[model samples]
Target chain A: MNDVLIAVMMIVLTIITYKGATLVYQRFRRMYTAPIILSTVAIIIFLLVCHFSYETYMVGGKWIDHLLGPAVVALAYPLYQYRDILKKMVLPVLTGTFVGAVVGISSGLLLSKWTGFSELIIYSIVPKSVTTPVAMSIAESSGGVMSLAAVFVMIAGIGGVLIHPAVMRVARLQGQIGRGVGMGSASHAIGTATAMERDHLEGSVSTIAMVLSAVIVSILAPGLTLLLL
Target chain B: MSKAVTIILQIIGLYLIYLLGTAIQHTFNLFIPGSVIGLILLFLLLSLKLVSERWITEGAGFMITHLPFFFIPATVGVMGYAYVFKGKGILLIFIGLLSTGLVMGISGSVAQRLAGRREKAHE
Candidate 1:
């Protein structure tokens, strides 16, 4: 079927773009050619030139979305593998995630308010630190702009890609858990991807950290909002 | 376990995870997704020795390896909002990017220092 062909083409194109971006990032480490950034540029061009609607693209892309649930569930393994270290750092991890999420969310809200942002914009901007999926949901539930939240999430990811290395270098953070947790919590999936490129261990830790960040942020965001308001 | 039995177990495991996740969400009034709650529940159960990692290993492992691929759908969804972001798109995108970068840099350094203290504390 023609639809199947488009689906296949969609995947192949995604792979090529991904690979190309990775090659660019690796080839120019310090120069910062993050694959997501480049791939996004490629996708935008493709969509514009082809005159394809986003919904049409969704038909192919949804196949990938179905995997998100299973994949998140899978994160248990890496955390399990690092169980001993996890146990030792449980308190610190919890503390760090709590602080990070609270500060990130509250600051965004306060800054937006101080700058005379509209209520809708404030709500959309508040959950910028949470993962994209959750952030979108929170924005939708609160009647904020889900699309704007998504854009914010992407921005967050790109930010992770650009700043992580320089930050690591400056802080002298060579350890796996520390680097990974930082990336995961701050940037979510994008940070995790960056960590994976740096090393497998860092990737695993980053994955855990990102999940941790999402969970903590989700739990606290609503309550904090209610309390502050 | 046999293949059929393993498949059955996976279905059961998924249901149980969902149920457990809902319970946690209700109890704590957590604002997160149910599935993520499921993840945290599963992690805690394993850590507490309430569940066998062996039981959930196959399904969970399969999920983790393919996690990165899952972002494709969400990212593609961005096309829908292309209108709102048209004029101020560049500025908005840059702000989001810069905020995340600043957070990552600051948090990464701080976590590292605190974790180092934790490591020393255990000794």
Candidate 2:
């Protein structure tokens, strides 16, 4: 199949799968039944039942992946629209992201070392909180498995989804923007989704936090690793 | 005629937007991503009131709302290493799983505190 044709088809399928899962989520009200999880399951089942090769899936799926960039870029409008709020919030957002990045790295490395895992494993584990593309790139550069980095990203997403609600409740944070930003900065996309569930402003702030978290961690992780080592 | 031309132009514009994102990432040596920079650029343009939000809102909203699904392709790529699943991968998975909670919980707390402080200072 032609790559462009495949990309178009995949785009259609992505839309269908996502929409279908969202409808189910609306009916069920379960995070476990969330659209992304369901859509991923649907795709995986389709692949397994039909025995489609990953490469074949990639031919079409890759195109949708290409849009990931555009989606990130598109987030700017919401962030921009909320710029006044953001200007007031910038110092805290920056401080929180940097501190979170540092703590996440330090704790991850310390825990891995204390557990007696190999250095290679620690190298892979420490960068897991960053977005997948950046984390994977760092993993590759630092000699961790790219595929493993992808798994780490998934784990991070799922972790964010499950725990962030309880965390927010414990903090007694009624401020939606703070709640959402915290979620996104830590969990990335999944956290951002949770934020969207709360409200638009929260979602937008979360998206900004998620993006900022990735950018900051990508720069800091390597330098921190060097200093720590 | 102009309506059709506008639609065509918008599609072209979106494509150019994506490409520009790629170019910036390559050029500026950013840690985050070129696409993200493109998003920031779009946000900046919107904030400056240079671009009409009405024009891009629909597409952007669609993308942002479904952002989680975007990771599927990359995650699926991980299946290629099924053969080595037992070795160190298990540990890697555990580490990933364990640390994510730490990352989100701690970061969320810290960010909240900072945002709160800033809010108070503003008052």
Candidate 3:
């Protein structure tokens, strides 16, 4: 296939798959059917079946990936818009995510160590609760495989989103604020998307949590990785 | 201006911020990514009223709304890592689930308690 042709195909395929997944998500409104998970899974299977390498897919996928940076910068808009609410809820949101960040790293470290997973795996998962790009950086600084770290980050996001309801119910969390913080701090962007789907205000708060948790993990992960793992 | 031009310009504005952030990160040799630096810089600009919300609103809204879509390709990289996950796939999944649950439960409970307390205190 020509470069130009594959480029168009990859971009079109991603868009079509994403749009189809969005429709299914709207219809069923299930966690599993969410566009992030569903479309990624569908495309992965499609690629595997076609025997197209990830590098090949990236001929166009890279174009889409390039948008991630601007997307991250766009986050500042939401953060600024919600400044007043964030200020009011600062104590809870700050305290909750701070604790959550520490616990996220320590728990992953302990569990991975106990299970005899490789040190590389331990380093990869240490920052799993943060967003993908930041988590990869953290893992890299810690001598972990950046790609493996990204995989762990994705697992954490999807797993956190998947278990959100059950955990919320059992935890008996009442306010939307807490739920937002919980989702963002644990799951990062994926969780933030889920929260946004339900309520804009809650989602806004989650974005703050997501960003703050990312900062917190970035600051704390290296120290913890050295000390514990 | 038409909505299309407005959106395009806003995106360009955001892209400029992104580039500035990357340049700063490179200059400082910082561990943080350029995009994150851009986020913080943009936030500060917004907070200080140096950058108007209207400027980035349409562009940011579009980007934020479609944020999760951008993560799909990276997440799909899992397919190539079957060997790394081989026997320990379940274990890794377990660790992810357990840690996430713990983080969520704690953060949610903590925030709920404190916020509720503040409400009662005000009352």
Candidate 4:
């Protein structure tokens, strides 16, 4: 198939798959059935079965990937809507994010070093907790593969969301702010969406935490990784 | 204006802001990504009343509500990196999984304490 024609077909197929996945999630009402999860799984499986190269998929997939930039910018709307609560509870939000950023970087750095990963892998994993685009940029500049860094961010996010309730109970974390900060700083957008579905307060706080952590991690990760490794 | 028009215009406005962020980043040679700078810019605009909420509300809301949709492409890319599923790649990801839980737990605990104390003080 020609590239542009294949691109259109791929894009259409992906959207149809995503929509179907969304309906499935809505029908099941299960966390594991989330649109992102189901759609990604379905699409990946379809590509593998069809023997489509990842590059061919990207000819169309990049269109969707490109929108991530504006989607990130759209985060400002929630930040604006919830500005009052944010101001009132600024103390914990700021401090928690700072601590989380530090912990996220140091822990990844320590583990990667202890396990004897290369410099490239260390840099990629260091920004794993950050939002996707920011993590990719940090990884790119700091000598890591952008795509690999993105995958690490996805793992951090999906893992954080999957384990949220368990971690909350184990850590004895209660209240909307605490829940929000945990997922936001640690999981970014994926966690924020999951948190939002349960409670708006937690969701908005997660957004705040996500943005702050992105900034903090972007500034700190490379320098920290370089120094430690 | 019709509903579709409003949504389209708002999205366009958002894209413009994103472009401006990129322009500034390129001009000044800043380290921050353009999208993030755009995020900050939009928030500042909204806060300062330079941009009204209605202008961005609908479009931004739709985008944020379905934020994960954009992530699917990249997530799918993982299947291509067969190198990552073996040996140390698996181990490295396992560590990432563990560290993610660690971040959420410790961060959650700290926020829980401080936020609860603030409420008690107010009470």
Candidate 5:
């Protein structure tokens, strides 16, 4: 197949899959239909059925990946829009995300160690609560596998979507800021997307929490790893 | 500005921020990702009134709404590590779920308390 044809096909297929998943998620409001998880599964199945090599799929996939940088930068818009709210809640937001990052990393490391996992696996899992780009970079620098870190990050996201409702209900977590910060710090982008479905305020708070957690974890992961390992 | 022009200009602005971030990362050897640096820079620009939100809102809104799509390729790339996951599947899932719950519970409760306290103080 021609490279241009392949690239176009990749982009088209991804958009279609994502749109379809979003529609299903909207209609059903189910965690399983969260666009990222659903589209990933759908694409994986399609590739497997067609015998497409992961490398070939990535030929066009890389283009989509390139957009992630710009998309992340675009997060400034929400941060900008909610600047006043952010300003008002700066103390709580910073305190919440910092605590959440510590809890997330400590719990992951403790659990992994309790289960007798190796040092590499423990390090990889430490940054799992953040978004993938930051998590992967932390994992690599900390002498862990980047691929494993990505998987753990996705699992954290999917788990957050599935588990948040139950946690919220039990904990009686009312108010947008509380719920949004919880989801974002725990699950990263997917959690933020899920929060976005609830309300704009929740989504905005989640974005802040997600971004702050990423920054905190990136700065702290290496030192923590050296201290703990 | 025309919508198309606004979108183009917004993208150019974002790319420029991203480039600035990359330059800083290379120079300082920061562990931070360039995109994140760009995000912080953009935030600073907006807060300082050096750049107006009107220039970026439409394009940024579109991108944020469809953010999950940008991650699909990377998520699909997880297939590359299938072999390593064979025996460790259960453990990884356990850790992911347990830690997610703990983080969510702890952060939510703490934030809610803090916000409630702040509101009461203001009142």
Candidate 6:
């Protein structure tokens, strides 16, 4: 296939898969049916079954990837909408994000070291708590593999979405702000999406938390890697 | 503006912000992602009334709501690293899940305590 043709096909395929998965998620309302999880699984299966190479797939896939930058920037809309709440809870949100960033980075570094993973893996995992674009930059600057960082980030996000309700129940976490901050800071975008489904207040707070955690982790990840690694 | 024009303008505005972010990152040698810089820029623009929300609201809402769709391509790239998983995928999963749980627990508890204190103070 021509490169442009393949790229166009990939974009159409991606959107269809995502929309289809989203419908299933709405119908089932199950964690396993979450659009991100489902679309990734479905795409992977499609590729494997058709014997498509990752390179050929990415010729088109890269177009979607480029949009991720703009999508992230569009997050400012919610942040702008929720600015009043953000101003009111600035102290708690900042403190919570700072502490979460520290805990996430330190724990990731420690675990990777204990497992004797390479420096690259350690660097990649350090920024796993942040959203993908930020995490990729942090990983690159910190000498990690960007692709690996993206994978680790996806795992953290999916894991956070899956485990959050249970964690909330067990920990008895209260307050929409608390739940939002926890989910946003730990899981990034996916968790925030899930949070959005639960409540408007939670969703807005999650957006703030996601942005705040991204900024904090971006600043701290490299320094933490230098200090710990 | 028509819906199509609104979407186009919004995208152009966003792309411009992204470009500004890229410039700032290059100039300052900041570790921050350009998209994040763009986010901060957009936030400032919206807050200051420099950029009317109505112009971008429709498009931004659409993008944010479908945020997961954009991520599908990158997530699918995971298949490229089958060897890493084969080598110590379990270890990676263990660390990722463990850290996620720890982060959720710690942040939730801390934010809850702080929020509680604030409520009490307000009361």
Q: Where does candidate 6 chain A have its weakest 10-residue lDDT segment? A: A196-205
Clashing pairs in 6: A7-A60
lDDT score for residue A120 of model 4:
83
Q: Name the runs in model 1 displaced over 4 angstroms.
A: A23-26, A29-32, A170-172, A222-229, B1-30, B41-66, B86-90, B117-123
At residue A91, candidate 3 shows an lDDT of 89
Report every candidate's CA lDDT.
0.68, 0.69, 0.85, 0.84, 0.84, 0.84
Per-residue C-alpha lDDT of model 2 across residues A77-178, encoded as one tens digit per residue: 667677787777777667766777787777777777777776776677677776777778887887777776666676677666766666667655556556
Give the top-scoring candidate (lDDT). Answer: 3
Per residue, candidate 6 scores C-alpha lDDT tens digits across B34-56 of 88788889899898999998878
All DockQ scores: 0.39, 0.55, 0.71, 0.70, 0.69, 0.68
Cα deviation of A206, candidate 3, in Å:
2.1
Candidate fnat values, all:
0.48, 0.60, 0.79, 0.78, 0.77, 0.79
TM-score of 6: 0.90
Root-mean-square deviation of each candidate, in angstroms? 4.5, 3.5, 2.3, 2.5, 2.4, 2.6
Candidate 6 residue lDDT tens string, A132-210: 8789888888789998999899888888887887888887777777888899999997788777767656776777778
Order the numbered candidates by DockQ, best leading: 3, 4, 5, 6, 2, 1
Interface RMSD, prediction 3: 1.6
| Model 2 clash tally, residue pairs | 2
2 or 4, which is superior by lDDT?
4
Model 3, position A58, has a per-residue lDDT of 90
Global Cα lDDT for candidate 4: 0.84
Q: What's the i-RMS for candidate 5 in angstroms? A: 1.7
- The per-residue C-alpha lDDT of model 6 at residue B119 equals 39
Q: Model 1: per-residue lDDT, tens digit, A1-229? A: 3888777777777768767866776788662676666676677679778987777676676666655554555566566677776677766556666666776677666665665567787678767877776898787777688878887786677666767777668757677656776788778876776666566666767777777788777777777777664
Say which docking band candidate 4 falls in: medium
lDDT per residue as tens, model 2, B34-122:
76667777777777788888777656666666676676675566556565448765665566556766666666666677677555553
Which residue ranges in model 4 land beyond 4 Å of their true spot?
A140-142, B117-123
lDDT of 3 by residue, B1-123 (tens): 988788878988998999999999999987677887898899999988999898898998887777778777777778887777667667888988899999999988888788886534422
In terms of DockQ, which candidate is stronger, 1 or 4?
Answer: 4
Query: Which digits, one per residue and each the tens of the lDDT, describe model 1 over residues B4-120?
Result: 577446645755786667677788876666667776777778888898878877666544443444565566566667675566544555555555655565566666667886665
